[model samples]
Target: MIPELAPAKACAAKVLIADDEPNIVVSLEFMMKREGFEVLVARDGRAALEAIRREHPRLVLLDATMPGMSGFDVCEAVRADADVRSTCIVMLTAKGRETDMARGVGAGADAYVTKPFSTRDLVQQVKDMLAKDTAARALATGSAGAGELPKDMPA
Candidate 1:
């Protein structure tokens, strides 16, 4: 539990952390909870996709590699679906190559985070992406004022 609110953090956006590694999952869950986001988990790509369809979370921290149906596949599926296309995706994995990042981007991932990532950086990045996404949604819906970014978000 995060005792104090962190700057740039939002109110409990549901986020899915999909990874097969137990240790990584545990750490991610704890970190997300501390950041005031409701964390969900899936051990494999299939389960991750199922959860995404069912929960429609605000964000998904997807592992690039899994036993079956890689994260690339999952991201592509999410992008193909109009309903879930707006969902923010952050691909997390050990593959840090330029090609891997390109593949993730082509698959519609909003961000790509490599393994051994700093938790603080991850949290900040999550906050920033979620904020931008919220602003975009407001603009899309015509709910925000012409001058005001959603929730006073900086330009």
Candidate 2:
């Protein structure tokens, strides 16, 4: 009989989404939950920071502009934190300017996505970031068990 490959282990990852826009947060949270991710929502940058500090999510999706702190500030703050410095950060904004993208990168974001993003694309990006983060953590811990996919959301 031919040898069979083992299935890859599913990893549970938590993601925090920070966006002032209610619609955006709702839509994203729904999609992320559907994809088996534990999600936390923050309506503003300051709240995002607090959540990150308290929850230490595996990934952060930050809106570029918010009522306070801004995405840049949140990214900076997270990066400066020793506890969660390695968390993956993706910036989402309506402005797609090169300078804006640069600013996000300079502020320590792992990815930048435009506001009018395709739901498919956003979900894919989230998966990619979480996978990358899991790999990195696995390397650091020297264990395959980095964290199961999160529980499914209610129908």
Candidate 3:
């Protein structure tokens, strides 16, 4: 009889929620945790940048108008820093104007989500962005087969 092998497990992805609004933070935390992410939280921009540098989360949900540095500032800083420049940033803010979106993108945000957004959609978007980012990184590093299971592994 063949022995049953345990399935391989991937590390849980880290996601940082950087927002000032308590309600939004709570909800985002809940949703991300439910989706099996290791969630981190920062209530202001300065703290957000600190966490990004220290923890190195795979993605950041940032707020534009925070108490100190501001999401744009944090994003720009992240892009300028070589260590964390590949970190994904998604701006979640009340500022929904065209210029605000443009500024967020210019500052290196991968996506911009406005206030009163649907949590379900946000979760889906996050998943898609993370997957795309991972694929891109794998390709850049010449690991295009990174996601493939080994030949000895059962399907």
Question: How many residue pairs clash per model?
Answer: 0, 0, 0
**Residue 26 error, candidate 1, Å:** 0.8
Reference-based lDDT, residue 91, model 2: 94
Residue-level lDDT of model 1, residues 31-78, one tens digit each, is 888877888999999999999999999999999999788999999999
Best candidate, lDDT:
3
Residue 12, candidate 1: C-alpha displacement in angstroms: 2.1
Worst ten in a row by lDDT for model 3: 146-155
Over 86-141, each residue of candidate 3 has an lDDT whose tens digit, in order, gives 99999998898999999999999999999999999999998888887877776787
| Best model number under TM-score | 3
Check candidate 1 and list the clashing pairs. none
lDDT for position 149 in model 2? 32
**Total residue pair clashes for candidate 3:** 0
- Off by more than 4 A, model 1: 1-11, 145-155
Candidate 2 Cα RMSD after full superposition onto the native fold (Å): 6.3
Q: How do the predictions measure up, each by TM-score?
A: 0.85, 0.84, 0.89
Total backbone clashes of model 1?
A: 0
Assess each prediction's global lDDT (C-alpha) against the native.
Answer: 0.88, 0.85, 0.90
Q: Write the per-residue lDDT of candidate 2 for residues 97-133, one digit (tens) a residue.
A: 9999999999999999997999789988888767666
User: What's the true lDDT of residue 46 in model 2?
Assistant: 93
